[model samples]
Target: AEECINSKIHEIKTLEQVIGKLITRYNVLEENKLKSLVNIYEKMKPKDAARTLNELEMPTLLAVVKHMKDSRTAPIMAEMDSIKAKALTVELVTRNRLPFATAGSGEGDG
Candidate 1:
């Protein structure tokens, strides 16, 4: 019985190790997929990209935008629907993660 228990423990340990590796592989693939999406967005015009991006879940959209250059992302933001653009801008501001200044209400008027 003791030997059987030891064997079971070993099997459990092996399974745990395999699970850990699988989780790591899954995460890597997900990261790569996000990177590929970012690359595709970077290649598209801001207006076109914004239209397509509107269909993405907010977290996924944020992840892609987070990887983009601020200059590039700004144009995309400008092209996006105002409500969505405002929501994303607010989220970024609240997280203290935005890299560039958002245009304020009439702040630029001379």
Candidate 2:
């Protein structure tokens, strides 16, 4: 009985390691996709992008904003609805504390 239990434990540990590896791979893929989306948004006109972005769910918008550079994020943000912009800024600065918060704070944007 003890030997059987030990074998089961070993199998569980191996499965756990495999699960961890899969999760890491999934995260890398998700990051890559987010980067691609940000690149597309960067190339778009801010007002047009803002109009499109306004329709996205908040979590998706959050991910896009988090991945974006200050210059790319700023104009779109400027064109967003005022309440939405304020809400997103609060979420970004307070919740995530993403580097984007400080990067554009005293902007001489390029």
What lDDT would each prediction earn against the true structure? 0.86, 0.90
- Cα-based RMSD of the predictions, in order? 7.4, 6.5
- Model 1, total clashes: 0
What TM-score would every model get versus the actual structure?
0.78, 0.82
Q: Cα miss at 31, model 1 (Å)?
A: 0.8
> Candidate 2, TM-score vs. the true structure?
0.82
Q: Write the per-residue lDDT of candidate 1 for residues 55-89, one digit (tens) a residue.
A: 77778788999888888898998999998898888
The CA-based lDDT of model 1 is what?
A: 0.86
- Shift of residue 104 alpha carbon in model 2, Å: 25
Query: Tens digits of per-residue lDDT for model 2 on 1-110?
Result: 99999999999999999999999999999999889988999999999999988888888999899888998899999999998998888887777666566677566844
Residue pairs with backbone overlap in model 1: none
**Candidate that would win on lDDT:** 2
Question: For residue 48, what is the lDDT in candidate 1?
Answer: 100
